[model samples]
Target chain A: MSLIESTATELLGQLQSGRTTAVEIAAACLKQIDRHDAKIKAFLRVDRDGALARAAEIDARRKAGKPVGRLGGLPVAVKDLLCTKGQRTTCGSRMLENFRPPYDATVIAKLRAADAVLIGRTNMDEFAMGGSNENSAFGLTHNPWDLTRIPGGSSGGAAASLAASMVPLSVGSDTGGSVRQPAGFCGVLGMKPTYGRVSRYGLVAFASSLDQIGPLGRSAEDIALLLEVIAGGDPLDSTSVDRPVPKYTESIARPLENLRIGLVREHFGEGLDAEVEAAVREATRVYQSLGATVSELSMPHGKYAVATYYIIAPCEASSNLARYDGAHYGHRTDEKAMAVELAAQRKALQQTGDSRKLEALDNPLIRMYRRTRAEGFGAEVKRRIMIGTYALSAGYYDAYYLKALKVRRLIRQDYDRAFEQVDLIAGPVAPTPAFEIGEKVDDPLAMYLLDLYTASANLAGIAGMSIPCGLSTGGLPIGLQLQAPPFEEERLLRAAHMFQQATDWHTRRPELS
Target chain B: MSISREEVEKVSLLGRLLLGPGELEKMTSQMGQILDYMHLLSEVDTENVEPMAHALDLTNVLRDDTPGVSLPRDEALAAAPHRDDECFLVPAVLGDP
Candidate 1:
C-alpha cells in the first residue's frame, strides 16, 4: 500500500506494522518540501540533516524493539517562535534574525522526548503581530490551496507547510486567532488547548496571557496525537495547568450520542460570508445526524472580542516583549552613542516649552527603552505595543487596560455560562474563506476584525478546535469551530471526530501543483 | 478623530520599530483606522466592569520558595551574540560610570 501521504496516525500504524521506516517518511517529507516549498514558501528553515538523523534514530530503536514515544518518527514543523536548541529561532523578524536559543522550549523538549522528527521552522508574522502572514519580515507564505492567496496567519507558514504535505503536522501559537484563523484559511485542523493546558515556556511571548502553543495537521486525529504529546504542566511556565493528561487518541473512537452543541449566534451574525455560514451549517447538520443536538446561544459582547483582545493582548505583549532590547537578546542599537544626537533634539523641544519634549529628559531610560523598541518591533506589533503602553501608561491604566481586563472577565463569564448548557460550542472558524494576499493588508482594522469569531476562546481561556467542514464557492476551505470548557479537550476532540466520521472534508487536500 | 502621521511616528518610536518613510506613512494610516475602530470601546459602559487577566479563576498558584536547578553561567551565555568573561557584552551605557 502507498503510505507516503498518510496522516500521522496512519504513518504510525504503518511504522508499527514494519511497512515503513522513519527515515523513509522523513526523506519523503523533505523531498516534498524541497519540491513544494519553492511555490508554497511554507518553511523559514528546513533542518534536513537533523530530521533524517532523528528519523534514523527512531528506526534504529524500533529495530532493537525499544519502547517508542507516542509520535515516534513523525515529521513535525515548528513555528519559528518556539526555541530550538542550537537552531536559528527567528520569530520571523530581522531583530532576532540570527539569534539561536541555547535551549529548547518545554514543548520542543516534549516533542523530542516523543521521538518526533524536528522537520523545520515555519515563518510567522514578525513577533506574531499581524493577523496575516504578509507581516512576516522574511516573506509571505502563500496558501497552498491558491498560491496567490494568503495562507491564514500568524501561523500561516505552519498551516501552509501541512497543507502542502511538507509535513503532516506542525506546531503553532494562537494568541487571538494566530492558530485557528490560519488553519481556517488553509483548510486544516488547528486547535488551541485551554490557556494553561499546553506549556508556553518556550513560546516567544506575544501576548503572554493569550498565547497558547497547539498543533496544526491534516486531520483531527493528527492534532489529537500531537496534543497528547505536548499537553500538560511544566515548572517553567507558571500558568501551565497541572492536571492529568487526557487520552486524546482514545477519545477519537468514542461515541458522540447526546452531545449538546451550542451555535454562538454572534458568530453567525453580519460580516460572516454566506458561503462560510453554509459550510458551518452543513457541518452542524452532520453533527446532528451523529446524534448531537445543536441549539442557538448568544454571546452578546462577542462583537467586542476583537476590540477587547486588541487592548488586552497588546498590553500584555508590550510588557512581555520589554525583555528583547539589544542588552538581553535579539537586536540592539548604540543608544548611548546616539544619546548626544537624541538629547539635542530633546533640548530643542524643551527650549520651545513643548511639553512633549520637556517630558523627554525626565526619563532618558524611557527614551532608550522606547528607541530600542521602536527600532526593533514591526509596525503592527509596535502599534499594539503603543496602544498597550498607552493603556497601561500612568494616567490611562484605570481607564483602558483595567477596563479591558474587566470586560475580559465578563467575556469569560459569557463562555462559562454557555458551556454549562452545551457539550461544545460550534461555529464558523472565520468569517470568510481565504482572501487574496493584499486584500486586508493595507487596512489594519479590517485585518483585526477577522479574528472576531476566534478571539473569544482566548478571552475565556477555553479549549477550541477548528476542523475543515467544507469548501467555499471560491473553492477555498471553510473551518467549523468546536470549543469546550477548560480541560475538556477530550470531549472537544470526540465531538470533532464524530463530525469527521460523517463527512469527507478532513480527507480533502488542497491542489499543490 | 484623525491620528496624525506625527502621532504615529511618536508611537512607533515608543514601540522600538524602525519604519522606513513609506512604511511610516502606511502605518500612520492603518493605526488611524484601528484607533477609530477602537473608539467603540469607549461606548461600552464598563464603569463597574472588572478587568480580566488570567483565564482560570484559580488564584496565583505559587510554589514555596525552594531551590531549583540554575543554568551554568557559560551554558546560559552560549547563545549570546557577544560575550566575555561570564558577562554579556553590549554597547556601553554612556551615562553609567
Candidate 2:
C-alpha cells in the first residue's frame, strides 16, 4: 500500500501517538506531488511554502504537548471552487485567475480549526461547467487509473490527486455530479452532502440551488471525518442548515442489517453498460449478504432527470454568474476605448437615418456589456447562460423556466415516494466508466448524460454517495451509488461502509507514481 | 433540437459571449445534439405541479433588514482590475456625455 492509502483516522492515530510528525507526513505528500504531478496535472497551484510552514507549526504544537483536533496534521486537497484566503481561489476560470478572497470559507475555517493541513487547490472545469476537467483554462487533470482517460469532473483534479496518493482527503463541490462522478472514475469515495448540510459561503456558485460542497477521499470513514468538521450551520451562509449536526464518524460504524435498499429501474435501462450493471448487481448481492433486503424500485420520473437538470441548472447559473459582468469583483477592461470605440459607433449609428431606431444599437452600455461577457466566459458557460437568459426572458419564462420548475417538483416527489418504500436507493453512479479525454467534449449532450444517475439527488436535495464497487472491463473504475433521504447521510454512510468492508476495491490505488 | 448557426450567433449575443463564425457553427451543432438528449424531461407528467426551487422545507430565511457590517470602500475597491480615487472605476458605462 502507498503512503496515500493511509486513512485519515489511522493518520490521526499516528499523529497522536507521536509516531509520525505533521511535517514528515506533509513533506511526504509534497514530495509525492512533485514526483508525480507532472504526468497527472492534478493541482492548479500548490502552496508549498504555506503548507510546509503550517505543518512545521503543527509539529511544534505537537512537541509542546498541545491538544489537537480530530483531523489535526493530516493534509487535505481543496478543489479550486472553494475560497481560500490569501490563496488564488480561481474557480478554473480566467476571469478570476488572479482573484483572491479576503476571508476564508466556512469549511476552510473549520478544517483549519481541526488542525487539518491545507495542501493546495486542485484543477477543475472552468466555472465548474463541464463533465471533464478539460474545461479548465489552466489545464486538464488526468485520471491516475489511466492517464489518457478523464478523471470525470468538475472535481476531476481533486479525485485524481487523492487516487494518485497526493492527499488522503480532498474537498470538492457538486453542482451536478461533479464530486460523485469523478470519485467513481478515480476509485474513491465521494459524497454530496444533503443540500445545505455544509456551508456554501466560500464556494463559488455554479447553479445556486444545485451547488453543494462534498468530501472526496479514499473511503467512507475519511469522508465521514471531514464531514464532521465541515458540517453545521454558519451565519456566513444563510442557506446552511441550523439543524443538529450528527456524529458522522460514529454513525459510519453502525452495522447495515435489515436495511431496505432500492434499485432504481430507470437507472439500469437500455443505455447502461453491461459491465456497470453487472458491478451494481454484484454490489447488491453483497448488501443482501450483509442482512440487508434489496428490492427493485421504480422511479419513472428519473428518466427526466437530465432534462430537468439542464433547464433548472442553467436558469440558476445565468443568475448566479451575472455578478461577473466587468463590475464590482472581477475582470474589467479599458474605459477610454469603451467610450470612444463602442459608444461612439453606436452614437453615430443612432444619429444616422436608421430605420429600426437602433434599438439594439442604441445602448452602448449594453454593447460593452455584451463584448465583456463574450470575451470572458468559455463556450459551454456561454451556452448555458444564453439558454438560461432565454428561459427566463419575458416571453418564454412560463413555457420553459416555470415549466422546468414544476417538473423538478415532480422529480423530487418521485424520490420522496420511492424512499417511502425503501430506506435508500442504489445504482451505478454513471451509465458507464470514465471515457477518453476528449470523447464527449464535442458533444455537450453526451457529456451531460454522464450525470444520469447522480443529478436526481441534487434536484431532490437528498444525500448521495459514490463508492468504488468494481472495475469495468475497459480497466476503468465503476462506482455504486447509495442515496438516502434528507439528513440521512449517516444511514447512507453506514450502508456504504458495510459494502466497502466486504470488498477491497476502495483499497486499490492508481499507479500514478 | 435543431439549432442553426444564425441562432447560435443570436444566442451568443444574448449571452454577451463573442463567438467566431466557425465556433458558432460548431456550438450550434453541439448544443442542438445536447438539447435533443435533454428533451427527455418533457416525457414526464408535470401538470398542476408547484415548482420546487429549494430542497429544504424551511422558507423565508432571509436576514433581517437592519444595517450590517460593510467592507471599507478602499478594501472593496482594492481588487478591481481598474480603480480610481474613492471608487472602483470602469469604462464609462453610460458613454460620453
DockQ of each: 0.46, 0.58
TM-score of chain B of 2: 0.79
* Cα displacement (Å) at residue A8, model 2: 1.2
Per-residue alpha-carbon lDDT of model 2 for A1-513, expressed as tens digits? 435569877888788888888888898899999999999999988988888899889889889988777787899999998887767888988778788886789999998998888999999998998888989989888999999999999999999999888998999999889999999999999999999999999889999888899999888888889988899987887788998888988878889667999998888888999999999999999989889898987887787788888888998998888888676666664556656765566667777957464555525555556666766677778878877876676776876777778887887888989999999999999988988988877778778878889998999999999999998877789999989998888998888888888889998876664
lDDT of each: 0.83, 0.84
For residues A155-223, what per-residue lDDT tens digits would candidate 1 score against the true structure?
A: 999998888877889999999888998898887899999999999987899888889998999877888
TM-score of each: 0.93, 0.95
* TM-score result, candidate 2: 0.95
Q: Model 1 off-target regions past 4 Å?
A: A334-372, B2-29, B62-66, B81-83, B89-97
Classify candidate 2 by CAPRI docking class.
Answer: medium
Candidate 2 per-residue lDDT, tens place, B42-92, comes to 665677788888887665577779999786787777677766877765544
User: Distance (Å) between predicted and true CA of B20, model 1?
Assistant: 7.1
